[model samples]
Target: MDFQLSEQHEMLRKAIREFAEKEIAPLVEKMEETGEFPLEIRQKMGAVGLCGLVTSPEYGGNGMGFLARAIGIEEVSRVCAGLGIALQVHHMCCWPLETWGTEEQKKKYLPRLASGETFGVCSITEPSGGSDPMGMQTEARLEGDYWIVNGRKCFATNSHVSDIMIIVAKTGTDPKGRPAFSAFIVEPDFEGFSLGREEKKMGFKGASSGELVFNDCKVPKENLLGKEGEGLKIALATVNRVGRPGMASIGVGICYASLEEASKFAKERVLGGKPIANLQAIQFMLADMFALAEAARILNYRANWMMDQGMNCDTEMTLAKYVATENAFQCARLACEIHGGYSCISEYAVQRFLRDAWVAIPSGGTSQIAKIVLGRHVTKNF
Candidate 1:
């Protein structure tokens, strides 16, 4: 198989790299310190079409393929992961709408989302449910022409800023008397819809992460995202197909950034009257980092290709998210060690990279969850 990037891909990568370095890198320190959302920078990403890489042109997107979307995430993440995650969640939230929504639903929401006129968020995780979304307690009872939603969603990214939310809620009763879930498009202005306090996170300080509360929130029947009882299937499929790749690409970008920074420092820092680049220890560390980054890039691209080809890539996507995120954390930690005392300081960016690296492991799926998935794939044990 060909490994080289096409001319279009090359141009896209270069353009994103230039924008990220010039626009996002300079604000890293201040954004972290002030805990600001960088709305202006996000608006810039929208104007440049980064917000809708995989969306269709009819909906104000570029109608590009999945590889292009992966590339965009990688490039932006290399400079600022918090901003990368913000964009990634936005795109992930749009996928369900694009894939399952009726043409009318698409026409109504996709354009504004693609144009960045309306920011979006996904609400699946609840105060009681994190890894096991099947245990989610959010309920939306049908009442004539509308649905009254009553539940809470925690750890919701962009919850405070989003104009629209894709909420997963129980809509019917199953054979065992358990609630059957459904997906709904909830507007922020809907009465009884409110946001909880913003979370103070260990990283991704520039992005908003908060809780969403629904207290008898009323939504029109037209807002139902898909057929009732299909919410779990839709949520899992969307998460596996699009969310995993987006998150894996972010890890790849962080690995690349860590390696780049460490290499630059190694070339300049002299020890024993010679540059650290001349030492075998530094060379080995850099080599390991490069190998991991290359593997991650390949894994990410392959999963994205499978998606474009209409192939089931559950195993490969999980592997990509697992290995890439763990490798990124390792690379960041090593880079910090290589930087010595400066790594501990907030000004150098190494510390920030270290903190950001931890987010990848849990964002898509925990390492334990990935291993369980791999086991199921290999042994058919589940």
Candidate 2:
């Protein structure tokens, strides 16, 4: 198997890396401190086609493959994780529509989303149900030509600023008396749709997280994302295919940044009348970090290639997300150790990288959940 990136992919990666360093790196500290999403930067990202890397060219996107998307995400994340997450949310919201929406639905939504004229958020987790989306309590009852939705969703990313939301709601009753769920595209201005309080998160502070309250919100029948009783299945399948790669790329970016910072510091810091780089212990730690980062990059890109080939890569994707994120967290922690007192300071980026690294283990799915998924695949159990 060839592990080298194609020339086109390399060009795209370098372009995005340059763009990220020029535009995103400068403002990240301010955005983090103020907890504000930089709309200007987001718009710039759209102009550069970073916001729609996986979308079709007919819809004003670049029509790139998943590998290109992964590269774009990794480069952007290396500079600013919060900005990277905002783009990830945008891509995730657009993906389900592209995969399952009707032609009319695509015509209506894809262009706007692709051009970044309209931003989107996905609402699946709720106050009561997070990892287990099948346990969602949100319900959408048919009323004439509309569906009346009533429920509350918490920990929703990009909820406050998004123009559209892909909402999951129960639509039917199963034989077992469980609620059958469906997905819908709801406008932020829909009646009875309101934004709840914003969550002050531990990291990725510039990316907004908040609650979405839908109380008797009436959505047209045409807004349904897919067929009834398919919401949970669709969500699961889409996340497995799209979400894991996005997250894995973030881990790669974080690990790269952490190791780069640590190496630079180690080479510069003097101890016992010599540069720390001369110390065997420092060299070993940096070597380990470099090895882990390279491994993560390989796994992440391999999973992206598997997705492009239309393989059933659930196990591989989960493994990539799990191992890459754990490696990233360890690298960040080690970078902090290398930085010593300077790492803990707000002015230094290591502290923020460490904080952001913590979110990766739980975002796409927890490490524990990934283990269970791999176990089921290996055992072939129900």
Candidate 3:
């Protein structure tokens, strides 16, 4: 298999890096201060085609596919992970729509999503749990031309900022005595659908995370995604296919940022009339950071490739997410040690990177969840 990135990929990476450094960097300070993502930046991302990467051009997207998306997320995340995750969750809305929505549904929503006229969300987590679909308390029942939705979604990224969203809820009981879930398209303006309190997080401050309350929310019958009893399947596929890999790429970006900052500080910081780059201890830390970043990047790249190839890469992506997120935290801590007390200063990006890294570990799925997945995969396959 070829390991080299294509010319298009190289050009795309360079262009995105330039865009992030110039367009997204300056506003990061305001976002960090206010804990709010700028609509201005989101619109800019739409204009530049980041919002269209995973969608088809026939539906107003560039259709750059999955690897391109990973590259985009990695670059943007290298600058600001909060923005990266916001966009990543936004991207989550596209995949399921493209994969399952009817042509009419696609025509109605994809253009708005592609143009950033509407921010999209996949609201799957709830107060009960995130990884368990059957445990969700959200319920939807069809009545005449519409469905009534009731329950609450918590920890939903892009919660307050979203215009369009996909929500999963228990619709009925299956023959096996298990809860049957269904996916539906929900709009914020719909009656009985209201925003709950916004969360102030320790990291990833630029994006919004909060609760989505559904109290007999009325949803049109046409908005049912795929079919009844398909919500669990759709939710799992979206998380495994898009969510984990996207978060893993963010972790890769954090690794890159940590390594870059640590290396720079080690070179510039002076001690005993010499640069700390000459110190053995500093050198070892830098070396470990380098190794972690490289390994994490490779895992992300490989998983992205497998996904683009239409291979069953759930296990691979899960592994990638675990490694990259854990390594990201390690890299950030090492960078912090290199920065000494200055690391805690808000002026330094290292603290932000450290916080972002910590958040990434649990964002896609926690390390314990990943271990369980890996255990199941190995036991079945081997």
Estimated TM-score for each candidate: 0.97, 0.97, 0.99
The clash numbers for all candidates, in the given order, read 0, 0, 0
Task: Please tell me which predicted candidate would have the highest TM-score against the true structure.
Answer: 3
Model 1, backbone clash pairs (residues 3+ apart or across chains), number: 0
Shift in Å, residue 49, candidate 3: 1.2
RMSD of each: 1.5, 1.5, 0.8
Reference-based lDDT, each prediction: 0.85, 0.85, 0.92
TM-score of candidate 2 on Cα atoms, chains taken together:
0.97
Query: Model 1 misses residue 145 by how many Å?
Result: 1.5
Of 1 and 3, the candidate ranking higher by lDDT = 3
RMSD of 1: 1.5
Which of 2 and 3 is the better model by TM-score? 3
Task: Write one digit per residue (lDDT tens) for candidate 3, span 1-382.
Answer: 8889999989999999999999999988999999987887777899888999999999999998888988999999999999999999998998899899999999999988988776789989998889776799999999999899999999999998889899999999999989999999998998889999899999999799999999999999999999899999999999999999999999999999999999999999999999999999999999999999999989988999999899989999999999999999999999999999999899999999999999999997899999999999899989
